[model samples]
Target: MELITEGIKKAFILIFTGDREIFEIMLLTIRVSGISVIISMILGIPAGLIAGLNNFKGKKFVISIINTGMGLPPVAAGLFVSLILWRSGPLGFLNIIYTPAAMIIAQILIASPIIAGVTLAAVQQINPKLKYQAMSLGANRWQVLWILIREAKLPTLAAIMAGFGGVISEVGAVMMVGGNIKGQTRVLTTATVQMVRMGNFDIAIALVIILLFLTFAVNLVLTLIQQKENITWAQRFWR
Candidate 1:
């Protein structure tokens, strides 16, 4: 109880004091995680949409791969990313190891599959007759796809939420690839781990709170977007 109280006090102090280090870590965390989520969605959405809409001989194999990746262990992802970015590794010429770029890469690997799998489920859940109807209305292939995607906006928003949540809370892969360099690649999740290992429980608690608050803030915005119509309708009724 005393520890919790002290931790809360420290958290408020760090936040109210506008501590520079904490501010930097928080901003970096958002930047890396947000970039990762965007890359994942860019790559995952089309792949998932194609997979869900088409039937092919190796479709199951592709879906199995996506499902496996969704459950991929963060440490394992870290190791895989590390190997690829190692000094003598195949892609080492780019020289991104131990950098924020490396951390973003690892996070992309962690998040892409989850976004892909969830997007597949969302697209698959839509009624097939909608596709037929769109075609019957003289919609071209691209138009049909756009319509279906718009129809699945709600579940797609859920997919965004899941992907964002996954990478924002991740630590292992970022720590491995980023080397947790202060003022460079260190982030909230990794900072919390470091503070705990060094026996600074108050700082750790503060970092954790910041992390939670960040996650909640991002999700809150997404949630508002997701439920905007419902909220508007409720307001009209109460008016």
Candidate 2:
């Protein structure tokens, strides 16, 4: 009761007072998650488009792998990334362990599959006839692909939101790879965990509040874009 109230108060203080450390954590969280989602979109959208629209051998196997990746555990991703970034590991030459770069890498791994899976589903749901119609009209492969992508833009936005949400809220993998160093790789989620472990429930709750607010803000913008697109699409359909 008191704890909750105190935490709420602290959250407002931190937000309104513009606490430097809190702001840094918030920015880092956004920067890491933002970059991760963008990279994931670049990688995932193409992979999903290719997998969904094309026919080839072992397509089912490829899709199965993507589906599996969508549900991959954060801890497992962390372990895998940690192994590769560890001093004795294969990619140790880069020496990015415990850095923001490492956190971004882990987040990308966590987010890309989710975006890809959702995108794959979205593209698959499109009417196949559209592709044939475009092709018959002399549209080249690239043009056809563009048209299909435009058609799926709304759902693709949803995929981006999902990817952003996944990585923004993630803790385990980032914590593992980033080592939660203060003023460096510390992010909202990892910082919250640190506060909790230190029995600073008020601070932890404040961090949680900030995180929820951040998530809501980003998703709200995305949702607005999505709904606007929906209305535009409906108008076009009616006309």
Candidate 3:
């Protein structure tokens, strides 16, 4: 209990005093996690939209695969990504096995499936009559699909934000792929681990505090989005 109290006090000081180490870790965490979410959105949303609207022989199987991947173990994702970047691996020529790029790749693998699965679920929740209503007016297939996507915006945003949350707080995959190099790949989670191991409790706790704040901010923003007041796009989505 004493150790816990001391750690919390030191953590508060580091944050209040604006420690450089804590700032750096916070910045890197935001950068990598933000980019990872963007990458997942670019790939997952379209695929999920297509899966949601189209009827293909293997479509169910493909969606099932994505749903399964949504829960993929982070360490396994780390190992698979690490191998691809290893010196003797197929992508070894890039020589980026233990860099931010590697960490981004691992995060993309972990988050993309989640985004896709959630997007698919959201799309599925929409009434079939909505699509039928659009098509009845002589709208083409693309038009109907676009209309559905617009309507499901809120849930889709929630899915993406959820993926972002997961990636930002992730420790295992980033550490394995980024190598947690100082001033280069040392993100919040990795930095926290190193600080604790080295008995630098102040910095570790500070990083954790920053992480909590950022996560809280993200959730608060998304929660506000839940009420589609000024979010007219989401309003259109809900209908």
Candidate 4:
């Protein structure tokens, strides 16, 4: 109880005082996760759309791999990324280890599968007849896809939220790839770990509080946007 109170007080102090380091860490967290999520959307959305819309040979196998990747262990992802970026590794010539770029790469790997899987599920849930109907109505391939996608927009937003949530809360892969370098790649999650390891319990709690608040703030905005078009029973009070 005492620790909680002290930590809350400290968190207020840090936030109100505009602590540069804390703010920087928070911003970096947002930047890395945001960029990674965008990249994931770019890469995953197309793959998901194709997988969901088409029934080709080995499609089930591809979907199974995507589903499996959705639950890929963070530590395993970290190790895999580390190996690929290691000094003597094949891609080491790019030399982006222990940096924000590396963290974004790890995060993209972590987030893309979740995005892709969710997107695939969303698109698949649409009526197959809708595609044929649109085509019969003289809609081109692109137009048909657009209409189908718009129908699944609600769940598509959910996929985006899920992807963002996954990467923002992730710690292991980012830490492994970023090395948590202060003023460079130190994010909220890694900073919390570092604080705990250094026995700064109060500071650690403060960081945790900040992280929770940050996550809440970002998701709250997303939630608002998501529910904007379709108010749910639970959202009645908010409306």
- Top TM-score hit: 2
Q: Model 2 over residues 1-239: C-alpha lDDT tens digits?
A: 99888877887887789889888998999899999999999999888988998899999999999999999999999999999999899999899999999999999998999999999999999998899998998889988987888889889889999999899999999999999999999999999999989988867877888899889999999888777744554356474
Choose 1 or 4, whichever is better by TM-score: 1
| Residue 123 of model 1, lDDT score | 92
With candidate 4 superimposed using the best TM-score fit, by how many Å does residue 209's alpha carbon deviate from the native?
Answer: 2.2
lDDT of 1 by residue, 10-75 (tens): 878987898899889989999999999999999887778888887899999999999999999989
Ranking by TM-score: 2, 1, 4, 3
Prediction 1 TM-score vs. true: 0.92
Q: lDDT tens digits, residues 1-239, model 4?
A: 97778877887888889889888998999899999999998888777888999989999999999999899988788889999999899889889999898899898888899989998999999998988998999889887877777777778778888889899889999999999999998998999999889977766877787888877887798778776874353355484
Query: Candidate 3 at residue 105, lDDT?
Result: 95
Please provide TM-scores, in order, for all candidate models, with all chains considered together.
0.92, 0.93, 0.90, 0.91
Clashing pairs in 4: none
The lDDT leader among the candidates is 2
Cα error, candidate 3, residue 95 (Å): 1.7
- lDDT per model, in order? 0.88, 0.90, 0.87, 0.87
**Residue 74 shift from truth in candidate 3, angstroms:** 0.6
lDDT of 4: 0.87
Per-residue lDDT of model 3, residues 108-208, tens digit only: 99999989888999998988688889899877978787778778878888888878887998999999999999989999999989989999887777888
